[model samples]
Target: MSKRGKVWLGVAGLVINDEGEWLVVKKSYSGLKGKWSLPAGFVDEGETIDEAVIREIKEETGIDCQVKGLIGFRTGIIRDEISDNMAIFLATPRINQPFVKSERELLACEWRTPKSLVTDHLTSAMLKEMASSTPHETQFCVNETVDPGDIFGYTSYKLFF
Candidate 1:
């Protein structure tokens, strides 16, 4: 029998500003190193995936955002035994503020036109695909927040449909 490792949960956002520009960030490490991709990161303990994505965007770009809906998910075996599942969300900035890039986790944070990202060789295929789809064009899963304290006596609960 094959021993399996724990599955890691991750989140990313297809954040588009009111002007219709997509948010892209360049990380300092991982497969995304030096590549402009959607703002993404691993989910920390005690936080929901939606919260994680919102935090990631804030940390990486200094922009506050709200998740519009669950857009999609990707799941795959990352290594011999470990696996990864990432949820993608369609989001929009809540405030019209300039982005301040994180010097610690990112090399660059910029807003680019979807067409520009699609044509930029520096943009990864995954990012290009994300940028190609707009919030209005893509279908999103319904996201509903529930109070777990009332149901399971937990802190938080979220339902994605």
Candidate 2:
């Protein structure tokens, strides 16, 4: 099929500590303002999914992380904006350190145990989906408009929704 706009492939990482805390961030973007989700972002050209996941974690949280495995994936279509496929990885930090929200687009980075994760706002669908997945295997999910054509209109930064 001839694709009109763009297919954005992104990555997110579930960086865990020995304490079993998972890394998460609040986006500062106008659309995602105050939304809590995994440390994730777009995959730059020529970047591997693994590399993108690690880089996103570092860039957003200021903590170095190593991709442990492909833990999950989530695809979403922002109608007439972009079609997104996000890879979620299991990761570990290179050094014992705290997360510093480095990017101006990041509001905060924190270690939240599963019990500590809140659902009052827009949290990652992957988080809920992850509960049903075994860490030993990969989990995948598809969300957004079912009509593919309506969503593949143009490259977008609408990943926040």
Candidate 3:
């Protein structure tokens, strides 16, 4: 069998506005389309995690933010598709305006509370992680060795309380 290889690496942000609501975006593309998630994207070469988060937010929501801390990390496997890992972080928006940057990649943007977010349709793993009140770090591993191409890639997000 051929050796497993690593592929793309991405980063995302969990930016919370001053209203104490988290930012969620509706993707316009396939895979996770119609799903609400934080503003996130790939980490470009020579870019730090914080830089990636800030840049992604600006590109997606037209809002600047400051990275506060890391919430946790996640790793997933895609049997015949893609496997990926991500870093979630906590952040606060620098401005109070709504999302102005509209792109084909995103459909909509809104602010929602953690409690309300849990009730809404969200990624199972993200919902569980948001429900916890404890401040801790955790990592998830997959049973099968994921092919680099099968890996959805790595992303980092900022979480705010």
Q: Is candidate 1 or candidate 3 better by lDDT?
A: 1
Q: CA lDDT of each candidate?
A: 0.75, 0.68, 0.63
Error of 2 at 103 (Å): 4.2
| True-vs-predicted CA distance for residue 116, candidate 3, Å | 1.2
Clashing pairs in 2: none
Q: By TM-score, highest first, what's the ranking?
A: 1, 2, 3
- For model 3, the local distance difference test gives 0.63
Question: Tens digits of per-residue lDDT for model 1 on 1-161?
Answer: 13323666889998988888889998887667787888998888799999999999998999999999887765544334556667988899998998888998898899889899978877865666556655455454433332212311223223232
| Top lDDT hit | 1
Cα lDDT for residue 108, candidate 1: 88
For candidate 2, write residues 1-161 as lDDT tens digits: 13435576778898899898888788887444675678888887787889998888888888998888886666665654557677778899999986678778788778877765644335544464454345544333333322223323423322211
Off by over 4 Å in 3: 1-5, 80-83, 122-125, 131-161
> Taking the candidates one at a time, how many backbone clashes does each contain?
0, 0, 14
Query: Roughly what TM-score does model 3 have, to 2 decimal places?
Result: 0.72
Please, what is the TM-score per model? 0.78, 0.74, 0.72
lDDT: worst 10-residue window of model 3: 142-151
